[model samples]
Target: MPKSLAEVEEGRTVRIVDVVAGRGAAAMLYNLGLRPGARVEVIRSGPGPVVVRTEGGTFSIGRGLAFKVLVEEEE
Candidate 1:
């Protein structure tokens, strides 16, 4: 099922299905090594944004942006 990144609890992994296209969204996310099929774990969430730990590194994405990152969760 589809869910927001913020909705994903910490320490859980999820496969990235799609990223919302924007002026530089793809490139930006790509720079972080966030591509389709990539798995990411939610490190922390709350306050202003959600933090996800990826292979490339850690990135902080706001709730709005996190919502755009469609993912299929895996338990």
Candidate 2:
């Protein structure tokens, strides 16, 4: 099932299924290497920023922004 990146547990690797953000937000995420089909590992998920590691690099996403990223568990 698809869930928000913020909902994903730490240490879990997930594939970005969709971005439910506005154009600007989507573009920003895209620029940060977080677009649809991108595979990212949840480095941290909690009250603070959600950290994700991708092939490009690692990023700290804000709660609101992370919530807009739809992801599915990998494996």
Candidate 3:
């Protein structure tokens, strides 16, 4: 099932399914290499920002931004 990036736990790897943000936010994420089908490992997720690491690099996505990122857990 797809879930917001903010809801994923640390150490879990997920594949980005979609980004439910406006053009600007989506474009920002896209520039960070967080587009659909991109795989990322959650480094931290809680009250603060949701940190994720992908092939491109690590990113600290704010809670609001994290919620806009829909992802599915990787098997």
Task: Give the winner by TM-score.
Answer: 3
Q: Give the local distance difference test score of model 3.
A: 0.95
Per-residue error at 58 for model 3, in Å? 0.6
Give the alpha carbon lDDT tens digit for every residue of 1-75 in model 3. 899999999899999999999999999999989999999999998899999999999999999999989999988
Off by over 4 Å in 1: none
TM-score of each: 0.84, 0.96, 0.97
The whole-model lDDT of each prediction reads 0.82, 0.95, 0.95
Worst 10 residues of 1 by lDDT: 1-10
Against the true structure, candidate 2 reaches a TM-score of: 0.96
lDDT of 2 by residue, 1-75 (tens): 899999998999999999999999899999988999999999999998999999999999999999999999988
| Cα error of candidate 1 at position 30, Å | 1.3
Candidate 2, 9: how far from true, in Å? 0.7
What is the overall TM-score of model 1 with all chains considered together?
0.84
Candidate 2, pairs of clashing residues: none
